[model samples]
Target: MKIAILGAGYGGMAAAFDLLRAGQDVTVFESAEAAGGLAAGFKAPGWDWSVERFYHHWFQSDAHMLKLMDDLGLRHKMLFPRPKTVMYHRGKFYPFDSIPAALLYPGLGWGVNKIRFGLVGLYLRLTNNWQPLEQTTVEAWMRKWAGDSVYREMWEPMLVGKFGERYAQQVNMAWMWARLHARTTRLGTYQGGFQAFSDDFAAHLRGLGGKILFSTPVTALQSEADGSWTVRSAAGDQRFDRVLSTTSPGWMARLAPQLPEDYLKGLLELKHLGAVVMVLALRRQLSPQGYYWYNLPKSAGFPYLALVEHTNFVSPEHFGGDHILYMGDYLETDHAYFQMSQEELLERFLPSLARINPDFQPDWVRQSWLFRTPYAQPVPLLNHSRHIPAVRTPLAGLYFASMSQVYPWDRGTNFAVEIGRRAAEMILTDGQA
Candidate 1:
């Protein structure tokens, strides 16, 4: 049997690896020259240190990722540490990660609001799970728990920052549950870098005789009369008994319009928020404890929404005692922030830095790199379930393994890999049936 997987992202790579293990011929096509789509890493010009454009970390619940790393013999490099996360509100930083911190948090009032917030969170963690969250929007859910004041002061800004204008009134509850559950951890990263897992996965696939074609963008797809799909790319076309797509559903609608009109419409309707992350390699560390801090109640015209003092979480010595900070913004593609030049973004970032770190100066910045990923995150609005396209399309010889399928679960390497494995199993069984 032959299989073709599009997009060398986690889902595609996972599907390719599993199919190869099943003794099937698998080929993966990636538009970029490397694997790890959104998770890909880039090294500095002269340094061995590398980091992902967007931050990535693993939680204890990410079983598939942990298992995959163990199987690949990269377990030794996996480092699980008690990472610190804080929140910035009213020009003050507050620790809000641990349960103790939650109880002691002063930013939130000491009244019904705090009690309601704690109860809702506890219910979410202990009972509701992610399934119930799917049926309601975050707005309604939050209002039910507390009130408009809490939502306005605490939640709305976060929603806007993460989802841009797509922070619809009816954003899905499942999305919030997944975010809350999966994120309850100290976080872990590889001793080398998060990309190490991607590199290892690609190498394992190659070792298993799976072919990966980089710089290959699938422009069109058609199902032949012979009950197979022929995927055409810049390189050429190939016929596969089974086809799986991990590309964003929006991109899928553009590449292969064979799906139903409504499905395609939903894909088009699915909104995404873009991001521009400016990474600064500095001569000195930004924060004292090297904690991750999210700027809340986003100030007007701030260049970045959050400042991740990575060195605070990880040792600066890892990057040769130099601090690495990530200042990121979530904006619409049409937003001026996206079109701003590197120098313009830099100019805006400096003032924000001085606010957070009074001693921050231009000379402290050794180097800066800007990264922009279009359609970076999907906004799971209230009716998110309705927006997700079916995995098994009406057409034959086609399947999908996408982040959209992991609806209640936020997009992650672990979820993508599990989805790929599940899709592969279904495809194999369907073939036999």
Candidate 2:
């Protein structure tokens, strides 16, 4: 079978990997010059390592990501480190990585709030049944079970930071449940970077005779009377036995107008948030306390949702002794973060740095890079599972898989790989059928 995969992101690549291994002729089309999609990275001169454009890491619980690495023979490149993660409280950063740290968190209060929060967390962690939880919003559920103060202090800011004020209260409880159920304190990363692993995997796929057309965007896709699909690009139209699109639902609808009107409308109705990240190389370390991750809620007057000291997680040695830090947030397309120039954003975020370190100065920055993606986060509204598009679309020989489909579990490379392989399996089965 000849399979065409759109978007050389993790999902597209993973699908191609399985299809190629299954003896299918697979060709991947990526808009970017390299693979990795949103998770791609850039390298600078004098740097031994490349850093993710949008900062990323894996959890020990990410079985799909780990298995792919093991299959790629790059499992040894995985590094799980106990980097300190701090949550903000009354002008101080405190560790919240373990049970004790969570219990000791001053923001949750010393009495019933903590008890309720703990009990609620334990319930969500232990329960395998999450379908029922989708009926209620995280805001309402947490407020009812964990108490208003607990919800206000902990969950609200993070929710707002993720989905923004518009959809924050609309996000379902199952999304929150999947997050706690899937995450681990020991964060993992590739020894070099995610891009390095992706590049290596692409090379390996090419060795297996899989064709990856990086920098080639699919201009159009439509089914033909002969039962094959035409995938048009700058290179030329290519007919394939099947087509899988890993692009956002909006992009998919635009590329393939033959999809039903109702389906296209449904695709456009799915709301999502973009992500803006500012990566800085500093002459000195940003977090003086050796902290790697910091949660700064907007409710606490913080402009950004997170401040990640990447070098603290890896090492400055990999980046030529320059410290790496990332300040980022998920926002609506109209948000100022999406529109602002990097210089403007730097000035706006600089004061927050002073708050993090009173003696800090702008002169400490060596270089900075800003990255923005419009479809970074899918808003998990009430009863979100019902809206997720399947790997096999209503259109014959046309498939759709995106981060939006990885519901209950938020977007990550692990689930991306998981969904991609699922799509590949369906394609192979349908071909056989």
Candidate that scores best on TM-score: 2
Q: Model 1, range 324-343, lDDT digits (tens) per residue?
A: 88998777888887888988
Runs in model 2 with CA error above 4 Å? Answer: none
Q: Candidate 2: give the clashing pairs.
A: none
User: Which 10-residue window of candidate 1 scores lowest in summed lDDT?
Assistant: 294-303
Model 2, range 1-433, lDDT digits (tens) per residue?
9999998889999999999999999999988999998889998788989999999999999999988988888899899988999999998999999999999999999889989999998998899999999999999999999999999999998898888888889999999999998799999988788888889889989999999998898889979999999999977999999999999988998998888887788789898888999999999987788999999888788888999999989999999999999999998889888889999999998788988788889999999999999999988888888877767888999999999899889999999999999999999999988
Reference-based TM-score of each model: 0.94, 0.99
Pick out the ten consecutive residues of candidate 2 with the lowest summed lDDT: 384-393
- Which residue pairs show backbone clashes in model 1? 133-174, 170-382, 171-381, 171-382, 172-381, 172-382, 290-312
